[model samples]
Target: MFEDGQVVPRAVLDSLLCDAAISRYIFGPDSQLINIGRTERIYPDELRRAIIARDTHCQYPGCTAPPRLCEAHHTKHWGRDHGTTDATTGVLLCWHHHIHVHTHDIDITWKTHPTETSTEKHGKRSRKNAPTGHWEFTDRNGNLIQ
Candidate 1:
C-alpha cells in the first residue's frame, strides 16, 4: 500500500507498526467490510516522548541521527512476538535504521548500568564511571553488531 504518495514496503510497514496508532479492519468471506475501528497505539504520545528524551538520538549503534529524525521502535516485535509497548521495551531509531532492522532481522536488547572496577596503585578497588544503560544489537545469525 501507498502512504503519503510513497511506496511502502513490508519492512517499512513493520517498522511503522512498531510505534503507530493502528486501526483494525475486518472483512467477511464475501469481501464485505465486517468491522472497522481504531486500535490502541503501540507507542502512545507520552511514552514516545519519554523514549525520545531518554535516547535523544537514534539508538542504532554508531548512528547519530537526532531525535527529530527518529521513531520509537519496539525492542521486540509487537505483532510477531507479542511484545509489550512499554518505555523499557522501546528505543528511538531513525527511519533508515528502523527499516533496516526489520528487513535485516536485527534484535535489540537493553543492558542496565554495570559497575566497572579498577585497581589503584595501592591495590585498592575503585569504581569507574560508565554509561547508565547500553543496548546490544545482534543479527538473525547471532552475530553482534557494533
Candidate 2:
C-alpha cells in the first residue's frame, strides 16, 4: 500500500477509522488539500493523540520535550507541500528543533528497521518497517547527527 516516500499511509488511516477517531470525509471539487477546519491545526485531534502516544518525546535525535509540549510536524511540510496528516507522515519536534528545521540546513528522514527485527508484537499493522519512534536527521552535506 506504500512506497518508502509516499504520504498518507493506509495503516494510519485504518487505525484512525478503527479507533473511531474520525469518520469519512467528503472532498470538494477543488484539488487543494482538504483542511478540516480546526482553526490553525494541521493534524486532527485524534491523530495528535495517537502521535503523542507513540512519541513520548521529541522525535528529533537528542531533544526531550514532552509529547504535549512538542508540536506535531509534517515530515513533508503539510501546507506548503500538501503533506499527509497521518502517523507515518508526522513527527513530534520541540520548538527549537522545529524552528531550526524550518529555517536551517537539515534533513529529517524516517528510518524503519526490517520487519523481522521489529520489536512490536501487536498484530494489527505489521509495522515491521514503520516509524518506530526514531528519525534520521542529517545535515545538508549528508552528515548524520550522532
Candidate 3:
C-alpha cells in the first residue's frame, strides 16, 4: 500500500509480487526480504553532476555524442570499494560506447594537455583513442576509413 500522493500501476505491482515469489523459490523464504542496515549510498547527485560537467560528452574517442545521451561509469567497479564511486574517477559514455568500454576489454587513454598561452584559456583533457583499430567514423556501408 502507498500514500495518497503515491501511485503504482496495478500491472507493475503484480509484476513485483510475481518476481518476489520467483525469487523466494530460487533463494529460499528469506530471499524476498532486503537487509539494508549496512548498505552505503554511492553516486550522490553532487558527484553525478560533477561527472557530467567534467566529461561534457561521451568519453569514447571520436564519439560526438553529448553527455545528455550518456551514463556515468566508474573506472573501478562500485562493488569493489567506495573510492571508485567518486566523480573524478568516472567517465561519461553513450550506451553503445559504454558497453564497448566495459565489456570488450578495450583500453582507453585519458590525458590533459596544457594550453599554449594563458590568454588562450586552459586546455581541456581528452580521450586519445579506442583500443580496437576501427575508426569512430565510418562510411555508409560501415567500412572503417584509414
Candidate number with greatest lDDT: 1
Cα error of candidate 2 at position 30, Å:
29
TM-scores across all candidates? 0.67, 0.58, 0.46
Candidate 1 TM-score versus the reference? 0.67
Q: What would the per-residue lDDT of candidate 3 be over residues 45-128, giving only the tens digit for each residue?
A: 555567777777786767768877877665544433322344445567787776664444343334444434323235765444
Number of clashing residue pairs in every model?
A: 0, 0, 0
- lDDT tens string, model 2, 40-121? 3356666677678778789877788897677777676544444555666667887667766666546677887654444545
In terms of lDDT, the poorest run of 10 residues in model 3 is 18-27
Number of the top candidate by TM-score?
A: 1
lDDT of 1 at 90: 80
Q: Which segments of model 3 are wrong by more than 4 Å?
A: 1-42, 80-83, 118-146
Model 2: lowest-lDDT 10 consecutive positions: 17-26
Give a tens-digit lDDT track for model 1, residues 66-144: 9889887878687667666667778999989988999998999998886676667776777786666888899999899
Let me know the TM-score candidate 2 reaches against the reference structure. Answer: 0.58
Q: After superposition, how far is residue 146 of candidate 2 from its true place, in Å?
A: 2.4
